[model samples]
Target: MEDILKHNFAAPNQLATIYYMKERVEDGRSYYTFEYGLRTPIYATTSFATLQVMADSLKILQI
Candidate 1:
């Protein structure tokens, strides 16, 4: 799992963080990549915390 933080230019004065996770398959030759982002206004601590909690609780299932 990796976390990256960057500014989001889509909206003015907004900050964004991108999270990436890679899962390898049993074959050792294949893998899966997952990415998500948290976008919020600058200094939005409550919203950022809520998004962080939601992101932490994410589950990836292969079907």
Candidate 2:
């Protein structure tokens, strides 16, 4: 799996196929490499409210 450095409060789902999608305010959203050199956006969320907002926003895109 491609090492993904996410916020301390972030969380990832059980499936190895999913993970915390790394993003930024400057370059907008971006993709991170995971297992098998797969590049996919994070689809998980942590209990942290701040992080939750970012994760929730992803739903709008149906990602």
Candidate 3:
């Protein structure tokens, strides 16, 4: 998991995934692992104005 985060993350966009597995022993055991990543084209917006613009453009495109 850390391996994937170290190898795949860049600077911007982020991603994560988790998994759980069970194993049988004298008692049952469960383990969990996770990975995360960052890439490009990610945006940090303070308002919905840009989203509204995108929605309007998509509506125009549909016509």
- Using lDDT as the measure, name the better of candidate 1 and candidate 2: 1
Give per-candidate clash totals. Answer: 0, 1, 0
Is candidate 2 or 3 superior in lDDT? 2
- Model 2 TM-score (2 dp): 0.17
Q: How does each model score on lDDT?
A: 0.37, 0.30, 0.28
**TM-score of every prediction relative to native:** 0.24, 0.17, 0.18
The sequence of per-residue lDDT tens digits that candidate 1 reaches over residues 1-63 is: 322224222244444443454555543333445454444643442112112223235433322
Q: Pairs clashing in candidate 3?
A: none
Residues 2-61 of candidate 2 have per-residue lDDT tens digits of: 222232222343332333444335345443322211223744333211122244353222
Best-first order by lDDT: 1, 2, 3
| Models ranked on TM-score | 1, 3, 2
Candidate 3 stretches with Cα past 4 Å from truth are 1-27, 38-40, 43-63
Candidate 2 segments whose C-alpha is farther than 4 A from its true place? 1-16, 26-59
Clashing pairs in 2: 21-42
Instruction: Give per-residue CA lDDT, model 3, range 1-63, as digits (tens).
Output: 344333433332434332332222333322232222233455422211110123224211110
lDDT for residue 47 in candidate 3, whole number 0-100: 11
